[model samples]
Target: MSFGGEAAVIGSRRLFAIHLFTATGAALALLSVLAAWQGDWRATFVWLGIALIVDGIDGPIARRFKVRERLPKWDGAALDFVIDYATYVFIPALVIALGLHLSTLLGAVLGVIVAVTGALYFADTRMKQPDNSFRGFPAVWNMAAFVMFALMPSPAVITIVVIALAALTFLPVNFVHPVRVVRWRPLTLAMLAGWLVASSWFLLTEPPLSAGIKTLLIVTSLYLLCVSGVQQMLPRRPKAGF
Candidate 1:
């Protein structure tokens, strides 16, 4: 082969390597499930958080390297979806069901609801709008499970929150895709970072989160919800023609 042909092959191999790196998040997520089964809640969340970080960075890395263009035969997005469902929905649901110590009936019901709603949400093509905002609650059961575990709320409150989040899966309300949405992106990321820190602290420490940390979390959560609400209320202008 000519020099140019050799270079092309090397570049393609590099892109494929990036694809494998992206899939590593799924492997980490699987390890998280094992941690949960071993009754190590801290390890479970730590692994999940690491997986989340991987998922967060891989998208930009893929785009920067143009992995799709380099490896047209492989579907990175589909692979990501598979991993996302496993880590974000399925494992989190399992953690909540087993770790939370809810009644058996309630735990089973919550698990089914989380798993089914998350799967349906993933299958919905219209879940993301042209503006790149999520058209619904976006099946963030991982975050939900984390919050629930940190708060250690009452069983009744847990039931209500779980059911409400599941119901929101089908609603038309727009949830901000922090990385994708242009408006308030910095603020969103800042708040998310704070929340993550608080969550990590709570997860690593003993049962209930500290009062100040808990208050910070609640404020951050409310801020994100309000941002979504405000954005939803604003009329969406027509996009320019291609």
Candidate 2:
């Protein structure tokens, strides 16, 4: 091949590698499931956490390398959605069952709700808006459930939160995407960093989250939950083409 063609081939290979990297999250998700099956909660969270990191980084890397532009045949977003459903919805449902020690009947019912709503949300092309914010709750059950795990909230409280969030999935309200949302991005990312650190401490340590870390986590969560609501009420800028 000519030098130019050789360079093009190398670049394509790099893009493919990035796709492979994103696909690894599926493996991690499976590992998480197995870990959870064994009642190895820590290991489960560890795998999910690693998968979370992979999910967070791959998008930027893909965008930076122009993966979509170069590899039009590969549906990176679709691959991501599959893994995301595992880590973000399915596994979290399992965790909710195990973590809360729910009866099998209860767990199955709730899990079905999570999986069904999550699948619908994923298939919704209007899930994300032009501003890079989610059109609804975004179905981040993993984080929602994880926070509940850390806090060890009452089962009733947990059920209420889960049901409420699932309902929010269909709402027209906006939810921020942290890295993707442009408004207050720096501050949002800073809060996200704090949340990751605080949440990591909870995941790494045993149950009975410390007062300080729990407070930090709560603060960050409230910011994430409320910021977009505030933005929703403000007048909209002209929607930009994505």
Candidate 3:
């Protein structure tokens, strides 16, 4: 075979490997659900966190390797959506139902609301606007549920927040995609790294999250919420693209 042909074959193999790596995230998400089923909340969150990290990094990696261009036969975006729904919506909904220990009636209702709203949000192709900002609240149920669990707030607070978030799913509010938003990418990424550290510490530490870590989580969450809102109000310029 010619050198060009050999290079093409090698590139195809590399792209296939990237696909497999991306798909492993789904496996981790599945494991998180299994952990939740076994009533191991800590293990479940750990697995979910790993899955989140995988999801965060894989997009840039795929772009770097030109996975879509090189392997047009494989739909990485579709695969990502499938796994994302599992980890982001389904498992987190389960966390509310089982881990939170809400009343049977309320738990069932909230779980259905979360799952259905998330499904609808994911199905909306317009979720990601032309400016690369999420047009709605962005169904980040996984992160929301994780923070709620870590904080262990009053059930009433949890219920109110869950309902609010569910309603926000359909609202036309711009939510920043940390990696994709160029104006604040550096600050966003730095805060995200701190959040990961704080989250890991909170998860591993004994229950009833310490004052400092809880404060860290709250601050980080607020930063995300406020930054997204502020960014939406700012005039758009051709800053960067993902």
Candidate 4:
């Protein structure tokens, strides 16, 4: 096969793999929500943790399969935008609406966080053609933090933290793209595994409301740390050559 043909084949496999991983994440998210609805906190945490694992793995899985190599710029951009919206917009709102009724202050804080996070997400979406670095906080990390905080009690404290973190997202900080380093892959996997186990334990043993809240906090916090820490720990991947 010609070089271009070989690349296309590799990229196609990778793209399909990424789609599968994304689907898995979506499935787990649904399961988590279902678990929460049933007042099975452990199950909820387990599923959410699984979803987080899927999210962590999808990019590397895509890279390993070389799906990105064949994807058209527009299609890739669209996929990224969709993923961001699902995780940042739909998932957080769903989690909050389902799990806890927020006070007005808490709602306001979350609203600001959502708005700022959305702006950053859109900024990244718009600047896809030239391969520019993202300028502000990553929506995924903010959502991860917000979700975890919500899982815990104290809507007031969570709101404060969210407001503070929302401001930090837009602050001038060097945020690296995550998919650059292989070392972090193992760490992320380990954390995800731990989350799964811990969440399962809580679901099985603890009181429903308490168990769910605790597991949610633990999983969310770990996820946020991974999102923020990965940027610092991993080197950025070089721009893909078309």
Candidate 5:
């Protein structure tokens, strides 16, 4: 192919990556919906968690390599917002509604989820630059943690965890965007490799390894949250004039 053709193809591939991220998020949301239909809380959590991981990185990945330039025709920002809202807010509430058998308590919980997430989205839309520092527990993480607890098969535990997560949803807590473009190197590659390996193992295997996979997922989630917290606490360099 000619050089121009080759360039066009590479650009197309980059755009494809961004689209793939959103598509993966949607797929997970769909999976959660299905899980709820079958009353499989475990499956719902698993899919919801997977979506969280993907949604967390999508935007950063797009910006990291300048994927935006590749698709002048497509609005990456808008696509991201749509995916984020659907996956983190709508899907989780739907899953919970189904899992809880659509009782009055379920309706109440769903309302809270929607309210908290809507506030988050409103904040995000007004941001001049997407803050690497989150101002809240992060709608996605709250949903993931709740889903995990829901799968535990203990009504008491699920109720307690749900309540705790609900409170957290409104409390400010930064979550890492999951990509640090400035520091892309061996460390970044290795961490990404770890995530891929762990997530793939969890998704591919069954039963006997379920407990282990859940542990790994929790650790990863916490690690990402911690990293974001530390970054936020680090003192920023003052302006030269100051």
Candidate 6:
């Protein structure tokens, strides 16, 4: 009956479609969950990978469409956060606890810690800084899980890494959001792209990522982890994310 939709309040169908596109990430997360439950690690990550792509693009697309003005009824950011928690925190926690070298009980406990802390981290109002950099570790368990799988570290080491990263959740360290963080952005994007390439290769091939590819993942992760320190070096006391 109208260009906006069947109802005037429905807003532009084209813009509403973008919000719906963002919502599809939840469906992808569900697929990832099922794949993880089946112990198909590769398939699980593949689904998560697709979901990640969706999460990465939806924001810019929504902005490009001025979705907020066009579709005032829906909150894209909140929807994105909900889908992100599932894909970035919950499912990755599930995969980590499932695939780690630890016993079922211990793994599950770690998963609970990850899930709980990650949820809390997301709720922190200061989670994002003025430059869009994360105020802390950002609870990107998906990447952590990927690194753990690629590295295949010992159980004790894996446990320690998990615990340490969880502890770092509330720390005042900075972590870059590849697409959003601007300083050294070219390098940041390159590292992000390198990670995607290496990880995709690892996923496409058989088990045991090649040493070189694994090395690439590690190097990229290290850059991401320490990039904040680089920023901090510029100013004695970097401005707080708040």
List, residue by residue over 1-242, the lDDT tens digit for candidate 5: 99999998987886787777777777787877788688776677678777777876776678776777867777877777676676666666665545554466765665466546655644664322255444555565334545353334454555565566556555555554445322223443455456556655755566445666666555655565466556567665554221
* Residue pair clashes in candidate 2: none
4 against 6, candidate with superior TM-score: 6
Q: lDDT tens string, model 2, 113-211?
A: 888888889888898798899988888888887788778777678778878888888989889999888888888999999999998898777768888
Q: Rate the local accuracy (lDDT) of all candidates.
A: 0.85, 0.86, 0.86, 0.54, 0.60, 0.87
lDDT per residue as tens, model 1, 1-242: 99999999998888898889889988898789889889987799888888899899988999998888879999999999999999889998897788888998889889889999999999999998877888778888888888888778899999999898888888888888877887767888898888877887786677657799998877876666557757779766566221
- Ranking 2 against 3 by lDDT, winner: 2
* Lowest-sum lDDT 10-residue window in model 5: 180-189
Better candidate number, 2 or 5, judged by lDDT: 2
TM-score to native of every candidate shown: 0.93, 0.91, 0.92, 0.57, 0.59, 0.91
Q: Is candidate 1 or candidate 5 better by TM-score?
A: 1
Best lDDT among the predictions, by candidate number: 6
At residue 156, candidate 6 shows an lDDT of 90
Estimate the lDDT of model 1.
0.85
Clashing pairs in 3: none
Top candidate on TM-score is 1
Q: How many backbone clashes does every candidate have?
A: 0, 0, 0, 2, 0, 0
Tens-place lDDT digits, model 3, residues 27-74 = 998899889989998899999889888888888899998899889999
- Cα lDDT, model 2, residue 213: 93
Rank by lDDT (best first): 6, 2, 3, 1, 5, 4
**lDDT of candidate 4 over 94-162, digit per residue (tens):** 454444557755665575566556656566534222222334455553234434533566777666655
Q: Any idea how many clashes model 2 has?
A: 0
lDDT tens per residue, model 6, 1-242 = 57655765554777888989999999999999888778888899999999989988899999987988877788988999999999999998898788877799989999999999999998999988888888878989999998898788998988998899998898888889887877778889999899888989998988767789988999998998888757866754345441
Candidate scoring better on lDDT of 4 and 5: 5
Candidates, ranked, TM-score: 1, 3, 6, 2, 5, 4
Q: What is the lDDT of residue 235 in candidate 1?
A: 66
Q: Lowest summed-lDDT stretch of 10 residues in model 6?
A: 233-242
